[model samples]
Target: MVSSDSQYSYTSSSDTELYSPAADIEHPSYISKILSKTKPDEGKARKSIAETHAEGIENTLTRYESSTHGIGPIESVLDEEKPEQFDVKPDTELNEWDPWHYPVDSETGFRIVQFVDNDRDDPRCWTTRARWNYTILLGLVCFDVAMMSAIITGDMKSPAAHFGVSLEVMCLCVSLMVWGFGLGPLIFAPFSEEFGRNRVYQTTLLVAVCFIIPCGAATNIGMLLAFRFLDGVAFSAPMCLIGGSLSDMWRNEERGSAMAIFSVAPFLGPVMGPIVGSLLSVKCSWRWVYYFMIIFSGCLYGVMFIFLPETHHQTILQRRAKKLRAKGDSSYRAISEIKTRSVKKIAKDTLLRPIILLSELIVFLVTLYMAVIYGLLYMFFFAYPVVYGEGKHWGDIKTSLMFIPLGAGTILGTLAAPFLNKDYVKRAKKYIDRGQIPPAELRLIPMMIGCWFVPIGLFAYAWSSYPHISWAGPAFSGFSCGFGFMMLYNPANNYIVDSYQHYAASGLAAKTFVRSMWGGAVPLFTIQMYHRLGYEWASSLMAFISLACCAIPYLFYIYGARIRERSKYAYSPVQGELKDPEQGIDSSAQDMRSNHQLSERVIDNE
Candidate 1:
């Protein structure tokens, strides 16, 4: 789920601010005793800033921009003793009816510099070409991140033999790496808040590339597994950051197409991983798989380092404030400097809230359903080899070709995403026309349509997997499964985000954590299960489990509203409640700041 707000988390501009007594203080002047601080005025109370904060302190910044005081340009003394010394003087001779600048809240005595309407500083105001370039680049990074997770699956046999270990031990390469995917974000997502997305991306990608070298050159299984886990940890940075990056670059209306690029990357990259790894290992050696990743990730790291700008709003404003201060004008303050979360608060939001939200039936069922889908996706990596390699005595390359249909089906599902989004919009309008927020259940419509495909695909693969049967039978069955994966995965995320509005990030983080753990574990037991049950029964077992999962979306679609109403964290808006179509939450710095931290935790757990 993408947070429409660009702010992530707050960091102090100066080290002294961290321990300063002023740091503990809330806004000095503005204090609303009974009103909702994070929410805007409701109904007829909505008005311009001048009308809302009429009792603001009598400061030079306030007097300059207040409508009652008359409009004038701000004049700053660059070489000043203090921030307060840079005074705002009126220029009645040059009053040309300029729009308000450096608007100060009457109650707070704080002047928050904001981007004006169509402000060039806003990322959403960037040229379309620039935004698309960043979008595509970030999407490719996501694909590359996902691809690395499964590329090792293609030729596990050669590595397993070389290390004098069983294939099961080699499966640790995938499992441990995936475990890193879940754990890395607990640190990096929070770090991205402090350092900003670009630095995190550049640093983590470089570390990931460096770690790949040890894996390709490892002499023992331990060394390979160790570095694979490190690389996974390093690569995990981009997986979590890209969603926030997309949100930073695109507005709600423009984000659907951009997010689609992101939506396909996780599934598509893994699908291609084995296909490419097979060709590399077959033509060269198993080590070439890691070598290929090193070269690929290194180049991507270089491109991103050079081209990606800091898109994070808090980070950008922090720099702007720093630059102004460098010239001795300390009056310009970014909201980040004024409002920040403590370590304790940050820990509670990221760590505590997600765990508590999981007890909700909506989160638990949706999470379980997603975990099953994720586990199924990982299962295919090992299951393909069993079905084709062992059952029919096929080569690595032949078994890998079978993944193409799966990739194709995932692409088809991605292509169909726009249509589904359109349908959601069309359906949501009926609720909008009646002055109500659309029920979160509307998100499950796609899931209901897509839930059947998994069982169908699995069933087809199961019954068709005989040594005598044509390869097309089990091979093409992947198409349906792949399609189902996207349809279910994407909508499930939306449902969680919609169901838990202010807490969307924690809900998503909880789901990702569970799914990643399940996905990482699946590859370990997949081969054993296949061998023990025989191909038909093993595939049939998964099929039956998936068939049971088909009930999840339907169950939620029917009763989700009631469930959400009872949920402690879920946002069940009452009918006729005014909700913004674009900015779902109230536009307040406190809310945006909280949202920033919330969004930072929405990692691509896949």
Candidate 2:
């Protein structure tokens, strides 16, 4: 008996697991209670594996039915709902269904292996100290991935001079890698879901570490560029998997604090990149930049391989089922094994759905707003050097220190995360009391408040960037920008996940692709933009753009519900009258359930 916490009760572990963050396996008692009400007879229903397993095993059924590639193991509560799909009959010997058959109760016929109450195998049941240890380690990995994006700027001159290329070409090093970050998720997010987080984490990170060696040793620009892109793609697995990994281990109420700690890594890593890169470039050589990444990332990979356990519920159950079968209990099965998907279906979900979701205004504006913010972060790597290094004659090492305030501001945002989450819970209680899900707009309050900080920082940095002014003026301005960056990032990801139910994965993929592409390109033209427009006006240009973006949160906050009501993919409380005849389920009922899950599941990572 899992106690129902109203704060997050909208999702049965089963409903929530359709998206990766929702995939926490709960006790079978809870699942049976919920599923028996929905499908009393159980056996005759032709529901997808997702609906069939929406009881105890979390993603076992949902991930399989939704676009996550396969389901996992659901216990005995629900039998073979879609026997037609499998073409199995009651008397057909168990071997005929071999790898896919549900474990049979000699009398009742169908059973699925499941974790019992307080089962040690469930990640959610792990000790608090263990979970926190993994959380910090995961955050460190995120920092390393983001750091690589900007570290090259520390001594761009050495690389450009050595290779006989221009500074603009060096900018490609950042851009191409960021581009890889975007594209990598399209492949890796699903891969992590299918293969389990630890395997993907170990494999891709090892590849990323290996590729850095080539980057360090490359004689030609071509070799360096090729390997840099590959490293980006490989390192990107963490950014995609860490969010889901955290979800696997933490319950709803406990996740906010962990996420706040996690959120700082992305911004802090980039901020520190120039600082480390510049120090090493001056004391050692530009090649030391790549060497540092190899050493640092290799160490993290070693730690992860030795310490991290498989967090994906489906993979764990699949392995458990395999072991049981090895002992001649052929009836034991994981949901993913019974459910099959075509390559075309998988591609549509991973590739085309994100693009289609962008057509929805919420997805587009939110994505565009994020892209602008991301581009500005990258732009600063160039803009600061122009203001301090070139304009005021400060050396690279000194100029790199200017990023400290930004890092401090991001840490400040992280400190504020718990309070923000607390505030949301307080506000949401009113709706919960009314038996209604809280509006997704509540998530945007932080974004609206945080939005002003970016423009304010930019305006300060712009006016203070004059050569005669104290460096303090331009340098400390980064604090607000960095603060705003962390503050805006987590809520925006929550809003997207809340707005799109089963489709949240694709929605996030869309945002990452667009954001990464724009962030990657910003450095290429930043110097030229500053020179042509003059530092003050160029900074003002971005500040004003950020100022304009402030409307995004308010606009969505006010009219977001209306927009979601009309959207096909975005979760809406107002459901249509349609019903599925074969499954005997009302579309409206499904939407309402999905709506509740959306309001409750706050995904802290994207």
Candidate 3:
């Protein structure tokens, strides 16, 4: 268990203890408790080979029944589809799945799961270009998912008019979608871990495509809102789980650049949505906006079905083990073969973890900070229209063009990723050279330098929107806001991923719940709030909130090791020499790696 106290002691951290962070083979992390939930005394005793085999067979069937592929693994059938999807691959990051592993090796009784040094088929073993293809594909799916959520921006007023309802009633469609997005990941994240990433993506998107057509076809605001909410639920998998997929394909050091590319999607989608919504509303009606979603997503789904392979390590290993079994080899089994846990236990843990995490002051603080930023971003769909269109008396298309500055700022901020990553690697190298445990705080360097600009940009945008100020003034300030958000978020996102490597999926799922909840809820009052407070003060109030949050990353960067020290999951239980904080990462280096292999159990013949 992780200590509640922050004043705990640490062991030595030498290069010789490189694998020290692995947990004890006997006691797994609490998140993993759902899979192998034997009594502690019984768990300490290794299982027999036959017991392992029986457990594997049962668990594999469970995965098969629930897996996204529905049929089975597609490695063999994918050969024909491989040529067009060239450079598709995985990466070499430290795997979070059962890192302290024990695989059944029938020939040698019990052993561990590991990749051969030259295993080209391993996604982690792929070339950089190949890995990027996998990453870019996932990012594209995420970008499109966000686009669907926000494409209603310009079409909002039109939908109300069509339904003969108030604007707030029609805005319920967006809010419901966001609320559905908040609810989605709890179901999807667990499914992906149980099955595979590709499976969740396929199933969710297929359901989403089906749900979207109905929204366009809807006759009443109620029907439209229902479809949009379900569409949001079905489409949110990419938003919540893409970070974990990126982790699967990239090491922590390389994650900054990839996360930077991804971070823009959520922000960009709202701005980009107005472009399509504005155009289609003029010529084709608001329904065409939903129609465009259908066409674009349908094509993307087709590409995905043919191209995306299993990326989760557990599922892929099971596939390999199954193939070996057909050839009369039974030495292979994944670490999850230890035992089968009850559905009750699994459900109890899954539903409660996000709450438990939020209970932690630090986790709550960071997650809240992320939610605030996301909420502000979502509210802009309404706020931007108010500021640029009504205030300036501009037409719909002209108002849509104004959003370009925010996108420009986001793109410019992403361009800073290489430097951020370079800085991370340089510092990481120094820690490695010192034989010190590298802290996840190294990723927050950008946040330390750039968080202040968030408030600054908000303040600038607030005061610049009047007729006296040129539109360029607000536009340039939009760029600053974009830059500031990117700077603040890139590090924040990467830090969470790095901090909760094992629970990354669930961690992010909980995050999305909060983020989307706010994203959905805040927009309801955005236009009203702006009217009540006036744009400058309303925007300045948001700026004040952002200014307060600027302290988060800096606080974590300083005391992060102390914070992680109290987390059972965060700090690897290793025994190594501790370095002073001023010197380097002083890790609790307990060799948490457990390799308890199953032995043969004799059975009496009837």
Candidate that would win on lDDT: 2
Question: lDDT value for candidate 3?
Answer: 0.63
Q: For model 3, how does the per-residue alpha-carbon lDDT over 1-606 read when each residue is reduced to its tens digit? A: 221112221222443332322221222222133223334343332333234433443333322222221111111112232112211011111122323223433433433343323334456556789788877887778778878877888767788888899878877878898888777765666576567788888999999999999998998877898899999888877666665566556554455567666667777877698888889988889999889999988988888888876666566766765655455545445534433345664564456665666665556777788888887777777877888877887777777787788888888878886787678768866765565545777767898888887788889889987756677876677788788777776566556646654343234445656777888898789889889998888889999998999888888888887888788655333425545546634324211110000000000000
Q: Mark the 10 consecutive residues where model 3 has the least summed lDDT.
A: 597-606
**Which portions of model 3 show Cα errors greater than 4 Å?**
1-114, 126-130, 251-257, 338-342, 431-435, 497-507, 557-606
Per residue, candidate 2 scores C-alpha lDDT tens digits across 142-202 of 8999999899887788999999999989889999999989888777766754677888889
| TM-score to true structure, per model | 0.82, 0.83, 0.75
Instruction: Write down the lDDT that model 1 would get.
Output: 0.73
C-alpha lDDT score of every prediction, in listed order:
0.73, 0.75, 0.63
The clash count for each model shown is 2, 8, 22
Ranking by lDDT: 2, 1, 3
- Considering TM-score, which of the candidate structures 1 and 2 is the better prediction for this target? 2
All candidates in order of TM-score, best leading? 2, 1, 3
The deviation in Å at residue 411 for candidate 2 is: 1.1
Put down candidate 1 lDDT per residue, 403-489, tens digits, no spaces.
Answer: 999999999998998898889879877866555666778889999999999999999999999889999999999999999998997
